[model samples]
Target chain A: MPEHAILREVGLRDGIQMAARFLPTERKREWALRLKEAGLREIELTSFVPAKVVPQFADADALAAALPELSGVTASALVPNLKGAERALAAGFTHVNYVLSISEAHSRSNVRRSTDEAIAEFERIVALKRTQDGRGLVLGVGLATSFGCTLQGHVDPDRVFEVAAKVAEGGADELIVADTVGYGNPAQVKTLLPTILAIAGERRVVCHFHDTRGLGLANVAAALDAGVRAFDSSLAGLGGCPFAPGATGNINTEDAAFMLDSMGFATGIDIPALLALRRDVEGWLGDERYSGAIARAGLPKTYATAPRTAAAPALAS
Target chain B: MPEHAILREVGLRDGIQMAARFLPTERKREWALRLKEAGLREIELTSFVPAKVVPQFADADALAAALPELSGVTASALVPNLKGAERALAAGFTHVNYVLSISEAHSRSNVRRSTDEAIAEFERIVALKRTQDGRGLVLGVGLATSFGCTLQGHVDPDRVFEVAAKVAEGGADELIVADTVGYGNPAQVKTLLPTILAIAGERRVVCHFHDTRGLGLANVAAALDAGVRAFDSSLAGLGGCPFAPGATGNINTEDAAFMLDSMGFATGIDIPALLALRRDVEGWLGDERYSGAIARAGLPKTYATAPRTAAAPALAS
Candidate 1:
């Protein structure tokens, strides 16, 4: 049996945030169902934020309501703060990822709060998750700009370690170290991940990499070597950090999954199905830029996509 | 001092081969100089093929003669057989890489000969290289389609080991495992490279990967992990395999350099200069499809391109 590696799709939330036109709620739902069918066992479907901030993820509640239809799929939404997490819990979300940028400037610019304030909010959310109504909610925190921040220039690894220590101790179930600016190199990932993982201790360490400088997949490969088993990816490499101008696409979901699958890691992703979804999404999100290689070149002739019925996402080699 | 890793520019040969319009000889000289000025110590300037076959390389002699101007740069060209190599030797090339496909079908389609015939030709070239004039020449065998092929699909690992053993014993000075069809995965690279390296023993093993399926740099990272110190890259990712339909770009020279630079590898590549070269090459080759990330995203604010004055390209960490 191959070792499991979870690649959760963030196209609906992270990817679509960049799309100019608002995709109808039905379209987002359709895409979500297609992603689930395409063997994406875990999908981050929406972000709970005001429509004024990001109109694309305005359908967060609506998408959250459709989670029941996505049986067998581990669905998640991104929540900005205590209020957002509370809303997600009220909307019946089983999982919500709270995002906090490690960079002081990025944190203020992105969520209109300081890094310490966000940390306080995260603690509040964790406390909220312990309440009667939030009993079943899984709270995950994404440390945005963990690798480096455009606003702050080089983000110190000590800062990342400091944040991870705080978040892990705050009772977070999982921590996602993000290369929000796409400034991360494989060496940085290799050097920093061990420390971040060490700080997280028993908590799961997931990585979110942007393909900004084209090292996204490479960083993922390094993280895999560092014992990380889960990743956050956007479809067709959609989504860019608005904070980092000229930065485009998250580490592409299809590309990341294809890479993992080809590496003999059990991703349980149907690449053909995922590519088909990419084509549809491209048509749907007409103006948004897409970045990836497999869709353009197509899968190699030797590829055998793992069946979705695989018990877990794991490594074969 | 960081350990040395060489990133040889193949954009002039591998990249421009895909260009529809012929670039002037002067333009080629200018780009080659620019590449060297950007601190790429090695550059695969052209291929020694008959002009009747690839008119793009018709000026091979002119470019080879111009090599004298590229002082301090280790330039090479591709030779199909002993005759082309003799032409290169006569033309003053100190290095020539011989092309051979691991896939039998690809070998026939690409070089118009059986794999064994090509091997025989390779042996003939090695014999010729050992003589008085060829003494100074460095011989490298690029086993194309070693990963997977568009024509024959998966090229067996045992077959790769066999070819490496034969080439190493047959007097080749260097071995390049090329993912010609862009079918290589990191797992496959990490798996195959150890054996290939073992077979090579004292001889160096370089990697030439096509970004056909987007895992180029990831594979580079894997090869680096397996102890490969040199790689072949194209400016702006300008090349593609003729046999692989829809394939675009060898790994982008600038992207690969940037990746290595970020990983703290001593590539001695001036990425800002490389990006400037990419812009010029992009303008020169108007229609050739380009693939890469850093060029589009620009280098991060924290990036400090290696000083061209550096003595070697090696790992710093």
Candidate 2:
């Protein structure tokens, strides 16, 4: 991992999943092309949840097929169960993201599965990764509602650490701590991040924050202070948790990139281009409420222009 | 002076000044009453600009008259020039905030005076404070566009320091470094804050950030780490500088207060109450854009309640 930060754009999967209107597969592909051209290295292409649950991601396979022929960008998809994992694997995606709700109530209500059942499925997915070529496939486990749960208030940090240890033991290549409902504050982020990093180690830790309660960036700062590097963000601050009512949106990718770039940290993404892509997204969504500061304010007057990095050839799986 | 932070609300003045519609005086008074009830102790009520320039504050006199009953709340007003200062003084406000643009270009464009002339007027304002009833009236001399000016990029830190030193030498009680056009980042904030504080000393250093480029809260955290305790925020993240096109809103007060309260730094403001008041403002503004996360997300499930502090009795003049 270079010192540069990685921002995985979750708008395609997490953003449109909650929209009232479903975008056509072509539009999703267009967004993917725009994001790739903007130098976003990783894009969560879509989720494999059943069409009945979220119609917005109903064209997941179509989108996965239409992914632009961009080299160096890793296209990933979200899987909630063994079936979703199978769909994602069949779609030729190199990376699969699995989410397990740490809050037992949330787990049951969201995926209709007990914690043990979810773990069993996760173990199966890890085993499946071994049978495949294994070189190209990356398996990431996200511990959702790690900070606090809406249905069950005050998620114990001890439980989160335990789950992280289990995920690490189960052979997840990456582990992300998610404040699914945006109940995380900087202090809580500081308290929980170190323990999770200790269990999962540094290379595996990724922090995902929602701006539901306005602590998204603050939590990011706290996690950075705690030594975690990779982050998950959505373009235009799209996406709200279906299970978490009033949970507004994910941390905006362009805004987060701008913040990181301005802090003297290299993000390897073009801030101006990322903002331009936001305009494309807004045009696609039409009447949706898109949130982010960089999209509205443009780049600051004193923005230090980032030097473009040579594009690495697209990885051949 | 306490380990806690103080977020002085500038919404009524800074927020509404750039608004397209003028709020009724009665509605403005109601906002003040509700903000006071929400435990906001310091509020910049209105700017004493000419009615022709900013008709939104035409009722500054009536607003000031209504503020005396708020007891422990310190009602302050912004004075653009000597005439505005006279109006504020005559309105019975003991605390008046004066602003001087540091960038000579910004100073000329904003107040139609050169930087040298603005400093001279600041000296006169300090002298005018002495001629008053000797009630120890507080005067805050704000260095607008201290970080970077829109018209002139790359504001020199030395000039910022010079202005701070001059303001303090002119006998102003407080000094604030303002990012008037939302052009500041954490690195710049961390670097320049100490230099300004070294010149202005500890308690006098205040930071005002605009979230125009999405680094507002991050900049605030950087300032806090640099030992700054006083901040300026607007309720609902209102206000934008019209002269600087593409300028976004200020840092939202309720959101900032929530972050501070959650960090175990006491801000002495009720987070939920402030959010509730945001609803009223949204209704009053109707079609206007209001930015804040706390109001939209509702309160977090595990929100730690603020420790209560009984309001001190109104101090005698």
TM-score of each: 0.97, 0.92
lDDT by residue for model 1 over A1-317, one digit each (tens)? 77778888988888888788899889888998998888788889888888789888777887777888898998888999888888888887889999998999999998899999999999899889888442678889999998888878888889889989998988898999999889998889999999988888888889999899888888998898888999989888888877777778898887888888888777778878888988988898897788778878887888764465555444332
Q: Mind giving the per-residue lDDT tens digits that candidate 2 earns over B61-165?
A: 988878677778888999998888889998988889999998998999999999999999988887788888566678998999988988887889899988889
Chain A TM-score for each candidate, in the given order?
0.96, 0.94
- For model 2, what is the error of residue A232's alpha carbon versus the real structure, in angstroms, after optimal superposition? 1.2
Question: What are the clashing pairs of model 2?
Answer: A71-A314, A72-A314
With candidate 1 superimposed using the best TM-score fit, by how many Å does residue B271's alpha carbon deviate from the native? Answer: 1.1
In model 1, the Cα lDDT at residue A76 comes to 86
Write the residue-wise lDDT of candidate 1 on B246-283 in tens digits: 78878988889889878877778888888887888778
Q: Backbone collision count in every prediction?
A: 13, 2
Question: What is residue A137's positional error in candidate 1, in angstroms?
Answer: 1.2
Judged by DockQ cut-offs, is candidate 1 incorrect, acceptable, medium or high? medium
